[model samples]
Target: MRLPPTFYPALHDRVRIALDRAGLDALLLDDPLDVAYLTGFAHFPNERPVAAWVPRDGEVLLLVPDLEREYALDQRAAARLVVYPEFPGERGPFTVLADAVAGAVRRVGHAPSTSTGRVAALAAAFPGVEPVTSDLVGRLRLRKTPEEITLHTEAARIADAMLAEGARLVAAATGPDDLPTETELAGHVTRFGTAMMYAEHDDVVVVPMLTGGLVYGGANSAQPHRLPTADRLRRGEPFMLSLGCAVGGRFVESERTFLLGEPTAEQRRYYQVVREAQETGTEALRPGVRCVDANRTCLDVIRRAGLARFLRHRQGHGIGLGFHEPPWVADGDETVLEPGMVLSSEPGLYVPGHAGYRISDTVLVTAAGPRRLTGYPRDLDDIVIGA
Candidate 1:
């Protein structure tokens, strides 16, 4: 799907304003998403590194490897395209990259010097050129535009539908009868997530977390993937699943915990605490509220519930093109909650032997408090799979 032409102009304007503020003549973007944001061209950065050099007042120039020249041209990503072909034994890709940078910027300002080593290499090419590492571009990206919010809302809808269907899949399965092993369950969840993304017209679906049972629990759960096992779905076992997918380069995250059967008193208590904490966090999301304040709301609830130590990670993070971004809902983040900022409010309590519960949802900061994008039941009663 092609993004609106105004999107690139708006992005260029933001960069130009930021550059003027920082006294920069040009901003060189080597990050794929950053490039795509400024140039509407989405290509693999690993295979062939591409850079978009946006001048403060002129046209944008896209420099790409010769093999990717046609792809860049097809996208019409830039006013001028500089293609460096691979001569069997000539200078490397850096030569083409350095020339492109020199041609675009008389003097560099607010150029990205991280991510790819090329950022620093380009700086070294010009002896007197000043290389500045300013996050102005990133800061500009923190807030979503109206169009971006629309795509995110659609992504959230897709995620919500998948999680709801996945819940039903778990509820209908009985141990050794209709239930699959942990490995099988993980595969099923991954497949279901991918299918849902395709159904929603998304080209790619990144099925991050799909695991089951305590076999692969430990710190591995923090990572996206855990190997599924053959452990049967016992009557009262707690199953946790977290999934994230992107639509049109915008991302959304959703997590759900299901109980195979009725929960014990202890399980019910823990789940209730987590749910309350999640609610507290979500309630705290509003325009003008500090990011840390929302996190404290959830943290305070967890501490009062006597599960502070088990709260390993931050309350949540900003959700956008990347799964994890800035304006983190943690203790020290002072970024004010502004309208158009979308974030995840996930408060989880994990205990090794007993149980773990996480209630998460995508929230958009709006004029009237925060709008919940993912509509799923958060109550403990709603989490139970089967009787």
Candidate 2:
């Protein structure tokens, strides 16, 4: 699921534009994703720092440990290699890193993720060079390229399949006693998704493209970020599953809340409200629409149902290399939605002692309209198990 080779050249061209606009001679990126975004060097991230140095008018430089030289070359990363002996052999990696920037580059821009200590050290190492902190790469990543969208579409398909498998597992059970525990259910769905990704795409990278999620049953579902437990599913309670997958560093999310059996009237009403909210939010995604406005439109549905107090979070946020990126669909953010921006449509309702209801799908803002990348069914009947 690697991006087309041509994608890197175009991406660097855009980065060069950003650098010139910022009045920077070059940019230093240390965040793992930012580094991978610019250079396609997807090594396992750890305490050992990996950085990408992109000069406005020259080739990109990937600074890594000596141990990773072969790995970076094997990946055919799109940059010149700048290898340091080890983390702290005789001199620290940062000091060795100064060799790349010293004398040759001045007025260098560092990513926002660069630690204050590292920034101070880099500054001290290169007294003549000015280190400016910028969001040059982060801003560029907000919009997906056509090639990125293709990978996102594939990832979304795998996510939808995971949800389908999870629903099947629930449906196979005749009653609460027959239901799998929360841990078992999540494990099964994730394992199935991982297997499917490998089987479906020869280009998928195992180290970087792992797919997984967790399930929350009954009252546990009320919290948006709870871990799956050993508890079994309860009849007449809500079950929530949120699954995400990545292909070639592109990502998407698909989620749903299901009723274990016949739902009570209150449960059905809550479910309907949230489902309507998600659909409304998805539809509101379009060119020139403000993110905050889309968020407000989604919240209106819950407010109309007199469940405004139950709202737990914003409509959603942008999705790409990072699971949660900027251009947030929340009150404070006013970023205008543009064509090629990919976001999640997740408007949820949480009642502390009862349950939480949410349906999230990856949506692409396009000239025609908002297109859903994850094609899983969201209707009440489609999600109700053993009904």
Candidate 3:
């Protein structure tokens, strides 16, 4: 996805700022998302050893595989593109990457410890070069830019459209003794929602997750995935749908629970608790507030509702290029919320014999307050699929 014109410049400024704070001459970014964030080129990192070397001054250098030279050049106008052929025997992309890093600065900061092998190889090649850990580079990317917020807002709009279509399909399919299989219903929703996003042709849709019934409840209780099954929708069963979509490498996440039929008293109470907890968490989002307070707010709501034991996970997490990012909304995280920070407020409750209800939405921290990107209704009354 091609980023907005302001994105790369803002990213460059952020990198320079980070470099100054970390006392590094330059930073070597090898991760695909990091490279795209800095250089505005999005491609599979595994295809080539692509790296972005950003100096405290001067233009950034994008070292890419020979095959992707043209594509990289077309995508990134600000960065000087350097191409290297396939690695020869005993010589890997690290050689070219090291040369690129050496050309940028004397001391280089590596992104993650996983890049240690590449860092060691570069140090071996350039005996005098120093490699330092600079995770702060990623920390700098935790907050979004105005342009990023726009892109993410567009992504959220697409997600909201998907939810609307899914809801309509569910309502239409529901009738007296006219239940559909989980796979069938999920396939319809996924096809429609994915098509709506892909029609824009600006961003690709990740795998859509739709699961239903007791099996789905168990799977969601364990973890989230996209493997919907053939379980037929029945009366009083709960189904959960989670979605993640990206635009220009920026991601938005949303999830909602739906009841197949009229919920029982216990189920209604549980859903109310989950919804209230989510509301509490979302309301707590604002600039300068501690991230952990959001989690505490939601947990406190759940605990007061007498379902604390069913709460199995933290309130939410940071949302950006990746679905799950840093600066978690959990206890002990003292990171103050900033105006551009985006987060998901997903507080869930799962009981062994009862049901699971989770509500999630991507929220952007704004000067006024937290603005929810997804517009689907969060009320329990609106959560029922059909009568």
Candidate 4:
């Protein structure tokens, strides 16, 4: 026995159980994250329709492009690797897939990430079999396994290192035209973390680091998700640094609001409010708690500070193989919190045209309660760049 990696053997068992419980004969996994979750078949999904037909009672069959055959075999993630030509003559990928899907099962289930064309092809093959969309796998994935948590913890460690580097870069800026422009700083953070990410690949299956989209100072920092610009660090404004990366297919996020010169009373107030809201939300990440309740817990802090109108988005979302996964932290989501579920506790205040202050961290709901994975400090003194 090779001793399966990334918990694939255990994950497959869960999928099979889900299939039986839901009366599904087979699960046709196509989402890159889902595929990686089930088979550890890591490959970037593109125009090609790569899929894994995991039957309830048999070995997993991975359908891959001829180009990916070698790696798929080397990894030995799938029980049986099925290779499709780059360009099939008359028998295309669809025809081949139909035969695989039609081999045993009748009730087929597809993930949300599945393509319309792939589903259509399946329908064409079995006209009476209507492939239903099941969140069974998604729900199963919501709770992270211990091995998955190990990967997430490593991802958080990488995020913390990169965030520390970003804060240092901001604090070390001597003048406006320093070595790192805002965009360059973003690249530096990503480049540094990516190098480490690949270096850690010896012990794990590392994915590309998803460098948190860095936004520089002043008005740019005020807009959440703003693209980095050539703008230099402003003296009186704050540089909101957000950083994230995936280690071994697990993702983690870290963020901080940094100020160059001393922050004015108003700037300090904004930063304090955002920080308080973040704490309030993080405190609620316990098993049995509702997802929306956690968001409100964070929101209430801002509401009391009378910055409620300034809040632009939900508190956060689940973080794992995907940056944003299920169980969104919002007012409408009623999903209950469970141990092993990982989420981001990020509450922000964005004052359009002036500045945006955001603090985010990956939080894991455990039996003992919430545990903050990203270790970057959120204190004003810790993040303040300039003296």
**Highest lDDT among the candidates is held by which one?**
2
Distance from true location, Cα of 335 in model 2, Å: 0.8
Q: Model 4, residue 300: displacement in angstroms?
A: 1.1
Once fitted onto the true fold, the runs of candidate 1 whose alpha carbons sit more than 4 angstroms away are 73-79, 86-89, 92-94, 97-106, 110-116, 200-232
Provide TM-scores for the models.
0.87, 0.97, 0.89, 0.94
lDDT (Cα, tens digit) per residue for candidate 3, span 1-387: 446677677778878887888888888778876777777777765645778878888778887778888877666545888777885426676566556553445677888843666777667766677888778667877888777888788778766666676667667764645666656666665666567666766535232231111224323333444366766666667777666567666778768888867778877898888888888889999898898887898889999987787877888899887788878999989889988899999998887655578888999999999999987898878888665
Question: Candidate 2 has what TM-score?
Answer: 0.97
Q: Which clashing pairs does model 1 show?
A: 183-229
Q: Which tens-of-lDDT digit does each residue in 1-387 have in candidate 4? A: 122464676778888988999999888878888877777777877877677778788888788888988978776665577777875436667567666653556788998867787788777766677798887889988998888788788888988898888877776767866736688888888887877766755645645445555757788877788889987767788887788887667788888888778778998899988988898899998998999898888899999999888888999999978998988999999999999999999899989888889999999999999999997988887777676
The residue pairs in collision within model 4 are 222-355, 222-356
Residue 100 in model 1: shift from native, Å?
A: 4.5
State candidate 3's TM-score: 0.89
Error of 1 at 303 (Å): 0.4
- Tell me which of candidates 2 and 4 scores higher on TM-score: 2
Task: List per-prediction Cα lDDT, in the order shown.
Answer: 0.71, 0.88, 0.74, 0.81
Q: What is the lDDT of residue 318 in candidate 4?
A: 96
Best by TM-score: 2
Candidate 1: C-alpha lDDT: 0.71
